[model samples]
Target: MEKQLIISVGREFGSGGHVIAEDLAGRFNLPLYDYNLLEHIAEEKDVAHEGLKKYDEKPKSKLFSRTVRGHSNSIQEHVAQMQFDYLRQMANEGKSFVVVGRCAEYILKGNPGLVTIFILGDKDCKVKRVMEKYGLSEREAQQMCKKEDWERKYYHNYFCPGQWGDSRNYDLSVNSSRLGLEKTADMLERFIRTKMQL
Candidate 1:
């Protein structure tokens, strides 16, 4: 590969998006910044780390949010800006990496090496994956899947310019229900290689 490769993956909850990101990162020998983006923002501060975890993927307030220090960003807004700044810095410096979620596809738009992917699964597959992974009852898993997808949609809609799962926003969108996790990752790899001429 002559150029940097940045793969931004967005997945429905329980769609094994994170696992697929991990697999791609390992295969391509790139760093993956997933949930650890919180740690990057918190900067090893235990209290802030826990606090940010609690606010994970939450949207900013439309009404009560205010700007301080010449910007009217809520805490969530601040954290998101910081995360996006890091992603921008990385892309600008020609670093190759795989980043999961936090509207990265929108954040790093227009980079020549950028390859955005959204992974979604059928409702039954997603619910079953959540149940087995989290040791939850079927009803609990179903509720979790619904809540997570809703939160992700709201977060993206609130902060980003485009719909969260819209295929037009990404270079590729794959349904994990069809090929499953491993095969889906492989399929995405093929797309990435051909798309980027890797």
Candidate 2:
């Protein structure tokens, strides 16, 4: 049987991380679990897709709620759990897939086939990308970038404190600004090929 291969991508906001993840998935012919993970959880008759969509990747929910499994958890906690649970199920089923954000790296820790990658770039580079993509002024883009990055940090650290953006935790760390998005994806494909063969 082939080994399970999971690529967990953690990235800074506006770093073109999602694009790179898509590139990697295409090169490897693996499934990318982003919004579809939410859809997976939403299939449960009792779980509300709108509820998960509303809070997807936002900061920790302040209100505690009961999970369908009957555990008392914050809304954020419950939603995050349902996603992680699905990832585990996929892994256990020996499926290889790539997951972006939602702290998949930490949540899927201990899986031998997991490849953890963190994507970051210079502030100017990221801000420029945001401005171009969102058609916002420089200052507005800067504010949005700052707000989203902090929210992602707070969200990630809420579950795994002090772990976000720590280069030590990731098997590979890339600066898309330095390599450019295409080159970065090409380089990562090479790395994943060699890494997975071991």
Candidate 3:
């Protein structure tokens, strides 16, 4: 039997990383996990989805008061564990899948079928994409990109030992802006197939 393949994509905000993943998933007929993963966690834990959204791709609040620190930390730990458990469960099913962000690459490390990818783009391209997608001004888009990138970095650094987006941590790191989203997707799909020796 062919081994299952799991593609974990870590992407800069506004980098079309999700789009690339979606395309790859479609090509491979694999389920794509992104916000849907959070939704599943929220439902399983009976927590408000909105509350979880605040913690996604973000570090624990450094400004929380001591009184709430314990509660906040507990909640964060629970959520992280839940997500990790779900990812592990999915991997064990031996089904192919494409999971975007939420530290999936780190969580699934050491799995022979795993292919970790990090997607980034030129700052100007990222800003443009964000502005168009969010209907924001250029300046607003630029600020949002920086803030989101920092949050992702902080979250990954906090939860995982390796620096996020370091090529050493990923099997492949591609700049979507250089190749465009469609071409990037094609390139990644081919790369994954090659890596898996399909």
Q: Give Cα-based local distance difference scores for all models.
A: 0.89, 0.86, 0.86
Candidate 2 local lDDT, 30-133, one digit each (tens): 88988777887777645668767767777765554544575656767767777878888888878899999988888888898899999999999999999999
Model 3 alpha-carbon miss at residue 18, Å: 1.0
> Sorted by TM-score, highest first, which candidate order results?
1, 2, 3
C-alpha displacement of 66 in model 3, angstroms? 6.9
Measured on C-alpha atoms, candidate 1 has an lDDT of 0.89
**Which 10 successive residues of model 1 have the least lDDT summed?**
44-53
RMSD of 3: 2.5
* Of candidates 3 and 1, the better by lDDT: 1
| TM-score, per-candidate, Cα-based | 0.91, 0.90, 0.90
lDDT per residue as tens, model 1, 1-198: 468999999999999899999999998999899878888767743446766675667787768788668786577777777788888988999999999998999999989999999998899999999999999999999999999999899989888889999999998889999998999999999999999998
Q: Which residue pairs overlap in candidate 2's backbone?
A: none
Best by TM-score: 1
